[model samples]
Structures are given as structure tokens and as C-alpha cells.
Target: MNTLPKPAMRPARPEFSSGPCAKRPGWNPENLSNAVLGRSHRSKIGKARLKEAIDRTREVLGVPDDYLVGIVPGSDTGAVEMALWSMLGPRPVQLLAFESFGKDWVTDVTKQLKLDAEVLDAPYGKLPDLTKVRKDADLVFTWNGTTSGVRVPNADFIAADREGVTICDATSAAFAQDLDWAKLDVVTFSWQKALGGEAAHGVLVLSPRAVARLESYTPAWPMPKLFRMTKGGKVTLDLFEGATINTPSMLAVEDAVDALKWAASIGGFTEMKRRADANLAVLEAWVAKTPWVAFLAEDAATRSNTSVCLKVVDPRIAGLSADAQADFAKKLASVLEKEGVALDVGGYRDAPPGLRIWCGATVETSDLDALTPWLDWAFASTLDALQAA
Candidate 1:
């Protein structure tokens, strides 16, 4: 039996998954025991820390004064759903989709919210045609699709002055990429992505426009207890200021605090951006030398720095059945996994056949370099396996 050679490259630590990514801040996990976790979140101390996390996050991310932060329930999904269910009635709704999370939003808009939505979509490897979207429509979009490794490079296409609101699901994009605040009316993210915090909480940042819409426009459906954000038919300022309707884990708040504190210590957003860019550079160099490899997303500018998707280009395997392609990718992923070269390199369940290596902010560039040669060997051995079959 032939085997891939062991790679000499080694990260300062092991890495490669998208979320629950390798811990960068390097806070002592043992410190969790000393943290105040089991206490009720409504207590003064709990709310204070949670408030600190929200405020510090704003400072680190440089959110504008007009945008208010809400510690909402659910991870990124919950925050996004709340925005969709609460804010999409007065204007025409446009759903921009390119990947799994974007597809989820499409389902929510058309199926769950049951709104009359015009879908501006591209396949897994492409970007939605933003040029054709009705600029005045209330738009819901995923800034970065973690599954497909595609992200919108710029927000210039979004009209500066429009009647509609732009609600963005920025879960993976929050700390990993720079956001154009002027183009977005609402942005939501979870602590679990680039921050490496607990998963139960989501951070919802609402621009003045979103708040205005909430006050002036109401959805045609019942406001469930979880989704309710209004009181007296007005957008409550309290919700944006440490008055979360639901209880949150205080420890999670501390973890978020630690993550944000970590971000600040590492020279803020610029440093995080640098790390991500450098890591992607490592992947790009690796992808260049491999003849059977190419980006799933065609354009370099549109391709995500956080999650990089790669496709196998061997002509013999290219025309194989879908199952065969999947099997081959899985075999390669498994090979890397066993060798400790990578873990969780498989494509998301909804995406096409390929390896999706996450190169988020928290992930160090050295790890990406370490994982590449291992990939080269894994695919080579897998091809040999396929030929034997």
C-alpha cells in the first residue's frame, strides 16, 4: 500500500477548521474554572461584563456611533433571523446567495419568512450579480460564505443612498474582513467564528436605518417571543444597550471579552487583517505549484481569505461520477486527518466536491503552510488509490 510522505512543515499549533478555529489569543483554557460561569446572566455583575464585551467589540471593530449593538439570542443564525423576520415588509426583498449560509437565508426569506423575494444568486464557485439587483430592495446577504470559500470583495456596488435596508449575515466576515458600514444597515455575527468564543451568543449591530425601519415598518407576521424587539411599536433603545430580552451565559460573555481583548492587544483589526492576508498568501502559493488544483471561486478578489476552497483538476477524475469525486475528496481529507496534517478539510454538505481549508483571522499562517504539502501528498496517494480501483 502506497502512502503520502509525512510533511516537515509544522504550525506553532495545529489548525485549519473554519469555526471553533485554532485559538489565537492563547488564553489559558484552565482560566475558565476561575471565571464566573454558573451565575445568572441577569445579575448586575453578569450584565456589566456582557455590556463590556459588546462595547469593547464595537471599539475593536470600529463600529460607528449610530450603530447600536445588541447581545441577541442564537448564534449568527438567530441574529440574522431576527433581522429578517422583524424588518422585511415595507420594501422589495433581495436575497444574494453564493454558498451554504447564503442558501439558508434564501430558504428563510422564501420559505420561512415566506416573503416575496427576488433571488440574485450564483453557484458555489461564483458571486451573485450585484449589478442587476434592484438597488431599492431590502437586501439580505452573507458577506462571506464559510462553506464555499467565497466572499464579496467590496461593497461599492451597493447604492450609497437607497430606500431599502441592507441586512448582512456577517458571521465569518466580522473580524476576518473589513465591513463597509455605509453599505449595511444591519450586521450580525457569532462569537464562535474568528473570535474562538462560546457559540450560544450572537452580536447584532443595527445601523440607524434598520432601527428606523423597525419603528416605521412592521412585518406581516406575529412577533414571536424570541424575535420580538419592539415595545409600543417603537424600536427600544434598551435592547441595544445591555438589555437583552433573553438570558446569556456570563462565561460566554467573558470568553468574548477575552477574544476582543486579544484582538486589541494584537494591534486591532489591521493586525488581524494582516494575519488573514498572509495566511491566504501561503495557500495561494501552494495552489500555484499544484497542477491538479484551482480555486473553487474563480476570481481572486472575490475569493474569501478565511475559507479557501480547492478543486481536484485531474482529467481522469474530473469526468467521474459525483459519488466518485466525493469519495476521492473524502479519502484525501481522511488521509490528512490521520496524518495530523489537517482536520475538517471536507467540503460542506451543500457544496461541490473539493477541500475547504479555513484561513480565518485566528488561524496562524504557519499552519496553512504546514497543511499544503500534506495536501499534495494526500491527493497524490488518493489518485493512486483511485487508479488501483
Candidate 2:
């Protein structure tokens, strides 16, 4: 068997794991030295820092002034659950689920919340029919399918004058994609994603319409204290002002502020989206030339710029049994990891046998450029080993 030589170049920092993704270029732990620590989160200083995180988030992300942005616990999951538990019972619900996380929300709505939602589902690589989404029903979906690497092309399908609230889990899409804020009633994301900050905290942005729903309607089930956004049938204005329901990691808040400041310094959301798009272009060019692999997203329009997923299309790999195919893909990822050229580039366990790479805003485009050659090398080496054995 012919041996493939390792690539000469490597990604400068290979900490790509999708969630908890690559940090901002030139990031250092020293940046968080001024983090408000060893103090009560309710203290004036702590609240000031938390409010700074929220203000900077709105500034960088171009969130409208009327919207309420709050720091929530449990990362993106908590934010989504809170929205599901607090505001969904009043309206007929429709769920669009194309990938793992989206399906999880479907489960939350159907089994946990016990809401009789109409679930519109598609296989991992495709999107549910947007035309079928009802204007009268509350809609739940992830703006980007993180595991499958399929993202909604745009918000055109959502009716501008619709009566329903559109709840979007946009953890992967928040900084990396252009969110149509006017179309989304409830938008949730985590700092651990695009900003590459610490986890365990979520940012929830509520449109005025959503806040109205929170005030007007109460869920049929018990609302956990952490999920409660209202008090005395009024939207808790303090939460949006940085008074958190639970004690938060001040260190994480500091990390997020650092990241947000970095993002603003580098030209904010436009530049962030550009960086992600450029990274995706790097992978797209490589996939175009490399016959062995193809994107998992069936439509180029739906291809994610953040979590880019790919599948081995070579007959030798594709022809294998399901388990064998998965093994080969894992072996390919393992080879890359062992070489230290890439890290955590394996496909999601529930996703098809392939590769899932983080191309979020924090990832350096040059790193992706450097990493592609290593990917080719790993594939060649792994394929050679497979044929020999």
C-alpha cells in the first residue's frame, strides 16, 4: 500500500468541537483576569458586568432596542426549555425538525410539555417544507441544524404579519449567520458556540410579541423557578437588565464579555459572518476538488456556514456496511486527531458517517485552509490502511 505523507502545515489552534468551539484569534486566559469574581452576582459590580455582557451582545448582534435580552442558565438548552415551558401552551404549535437538536425540541414539546404540536420532519440532510408552516400556529425550529449542518436559507417563509410566534434555537447561527430578528419572536443562543466563550449560560432575546404572550398566557404545567420570566403576570424587566434568576458563573460572564469585546473590535456581526463564510468557502473548495467527500447538506442553499458536515462519497467507503462505514469515518477522524492537525472533527454519533467541522466566527479562516490539506492526507492514509487490512 502506498503511504501518504503528512501535511506540512497545521491549524495554529485546533480546538474545534462545534459547541465550545474555537476561541477568538489571539485569545488568552489573561484576558479574563479582570472578571468580576469573589463577589455576589447580585452585587452592583456583578450586575454591571452582566449588563455589560447583555449590552455588548445587543450592540454586536444588532438586536433591536425594543427586544429584551437576558442571561439565562443551562446554556442554549435552558433558554429553549424556558421558552417552551413558559410561552407555548397558549397557541397551536408547529415544529420544524431536520436534525438532532430540532428533534429534541419536538420531544420536549410532545412528550414533556405534552403539547399536541404538528411535527414537520425531514431527514438529516434536508429541511422540512416551509410552505406548510402554519401562520396561525406557534413555530419552533433551530435556525441551524448543528449536527447535520443544514440551516434555513432565510426567513422569507415566515409571514411578516403572522399571528404566531416563531421560537428559534439559534445557538449555532447567532453570530455566524444573519438572523432576521423581526421574524423571530424568541431567539436563543449560547456563548459557547460562535463566540467560543465558556458554557452554562444562554442569551435569550424576546421580541415584544413574545413578552406579551408570556404576560398574557400561563402554561398548563408547573413552571420551574429558573424558567420563570414573569412575576405578578408581568414580564420581569429586571432579568433583561441583568438580574439573573440564579447565581451565574462570573468567570463565564467575563469570558463572554471578552469575546463580545473582541467581536466588536473585529467589526462585529458583519465581520463575524464574513469570517464564518470564508471558512466555509475553504471547506467547499476542498470538497469540490476532493471526489472522496461531499457535503451532507443536500442543498447548497441550506448548507451551514458554522457546523459544516461532510460525508465520504468514495465508493470504497460508501459501499461498506453501516457499521463499517462509521468505523472508517471514525478512523479517518482519529488519524487526523493523532496527527494533531485537527481535533474533534468526527461526525455526530446520530449523523451519517462523515466529518463535522466547526467553521464558526471564532475559527481562523487560515486555520481551515491549513487544515484541509491535513484532511486529505488523513483520508488517504486511512483509506490505504483500510484496503490493506
Candidate 3:
């Protein structure tokens, strides 16, 4: 039987869920005191606050001056859907899918929209072949696969000069990775991922090319009022200037601004990337020494620093049936949660049986460092219980 002792030191803050991740360090409810509550979003004060969110986003991410940044409803999912429904019918489409969210986009293109899109896919822990991509076809892909813990290493595969536009879902990669903005036409993300802001709101960034597509092409199907971005063959400039299509929760807007301010105060995206990288390094070190666990990402270059997934490599666990392995992983996660060292660390439902830990910028490296020992204890204790059973 395994005889590992329980860990004495626990993480000071353990809000490690991948989505709606931990808030910025030293965050307080008082930070949102400036929110303009009980006012229409179209009012002066409300519009100014919304505009601040867009401006701060561009400043921190180094977005191009020509690109238009806007706040859209429905988190990252909403932003992507709007883009697909608005601009995809103009040309041939190609999609790269390696994870659950990526697969969802493929479904939207094929099943929902009924577009004849060419799909390139890979199993979990790997990326689709970028060489197979065609420059003539409009491309849709995720910069980082949050569920599978994989990400495209860079934007080198995208053609520098191509007829097609590229749409990127960068929800998890926005604040934590370097994005090659010049190569991308449309990019979408959420405030809740790396910045740890409030959820249900998405940020959509469109290049001049993307705006041109919006102004030129109209989908054959009916466009929902919420998805409309153009009027009389012209892109809606008001949306980019913070005139939202629907009423927004001012409290959530306030929380987003607070998070952006925190990001800027700490030297902006560079510092955020450094913190996330350091947090990932902690897990890398642990996995290198731990005999049982391995990263779900097959290649080091493709591994994600934010949603770091891990699989059990020990023969005892790997030898079990698929359902049994999933149950074991659940038991391991429960042990950590019961001990209060980690919460919501289980792998995504559609992903392989394993563990997924959030290592976003808002998560402290010290907390990750503290949590590794607890992970070891949980694994050992779970294994012991299984052997006894």
C-alpha cells in the first residue's frame, strides 16, 4: 500500500478553474466602485465606461490602430458565432479543429450553417497539419485549445498575402501569449480567461479586411438582430465605438475595467505572460520528476501555458478501462478538493480522462508551487485506495 504523508502546506488561494478563473491578486469588491449602475448603456457615462474597456484591451494587447475593437454579447462563443454567420458565405472555408471548442466551430460551419467547409482535424494532444491549409480558403481556427491544452506555436502557417481572411478564437491565449496580429483578420476573446474578469461578455477585434468582408458580403440565410454588424452595405461604426446592440451589465463592465487596470499596473501583457509561463514551469518541473503523470500535449512547442492538461502514464491507471480511468481521475480530483488544495481540476468532459489545471496570469506561481505536493499526495492516496479495493 502507498504510504505518502498528507501535505501540510496548502495554497493560499485555490480558485483554479479554467474558465472564470481566479481573479487578479489583491482584488477586492471595492475596486468596482466606479461602475455606472441603473443607467442605460447608451447614456454618456455608460458608453464612456464601455469604450474604456475596448481602449484598454487594444493598449495592453498591442492591437493595430486600424483594427476595430468592440464588446459583443455571449462571451467568446458569441463573438465567434457572430463572425461566422456574418462573413463566411463569401468564399471557400477551411477549419482546423483539435479540441472541443474547435470541433464546435466545425459543427457551426457544417451542420448549423450548412456550409461545405473543408475540415482538418487531429486527435487530442496534437495539432492539425498546418501545411495542408490553403491560402485561398477563409480559415477558422483556435489559437489555443483550452480543453486539450494544445495551441498553435505561432502564426507562421498563415500566408502573409492571401485572398482569404483568418478568424482566430484566442479566448485563452489573449493575455498569455504573443499573437501575430498582422496575419489575422478577425480575433475574438473573453475577459474571463487570462485576465480573470467577469463572464458572458466577449471582445471582437476586426481588421480593415474583416470590415470590408462584412460590408461586402451578406449571408443567404436570415441574420439575427444580435448578429447584424452591417447596415445598408456599410459596417456599423457605432458598435466599435461602444454603442452595444443590447443592454449590458454595468457591474460586469466595471469588473472588466478593474481587471484591465490591474493588468496595466503590473507592466501589461509582458508581465502577464511571464507570470503564466512561470506557473507552467512549476508544473513542468513537477511532471518531470513525478513518474505517474505526463502532459496531454504531445509536443512541447504546442503545449498551452494556461490550461495545462495532464494524463496518468502509470501502467496501473492506464491499464484500466476508459470509464474506470475516468472514475479514478474523478476520485483524484475529489481528494484534492476535499483537502481544499485545488478545486475543479478534473479534465474537460469531452477530453481524455486526466487533470486540467489553470495556470493563467491571475494565478500565482506560489500557489501552483504549493499545490504540487498536494497533487502528489492525492494521487498516492487514491492509488492506495484503489489497490485496497
- Which residue runs does candidate 3 get wrong by more than 4 Å? none
Give the clashing residue pairs of candidate 1, or none.
306-359
Measured by lDDT, the strongest candidate is 3
Give residue 156's error in model 1 in angstroms. Answer: 1.1
Off by over 4 Å in 2: none
Q: Which scores higher on lDDT, 1 or 2?
A: 2
Model 1 lowest lDDT segment of ten = 30-39
Worst 10 residues of 3 by lDDT: 1-10
* Alpha-carbon lDDT of model 3: 0.95
TM-score of each model, in listed order: 0.96, 0.99, 0.99
Expressed as tens digits, the lDDT of each residue in 6-93 for candidate 1 is 6677555656777766666466776455455777676777777777888999988999988999999999999998999999988899
Give one digit per residue, the lDDT tens place, for model 3 in 2-72.
Answer: 85888788999988999989999999999999899988999999999999999999999999999999999
Query: What do the candidate models score in CA lDDT, each in turn?
Result: 0.84, 0.93, 0.95
Q: Rank the candidates by lDDT, best first.
A: 3, 2, 1
- Per-candidate clashes, comma-separated: 1, 0, 0
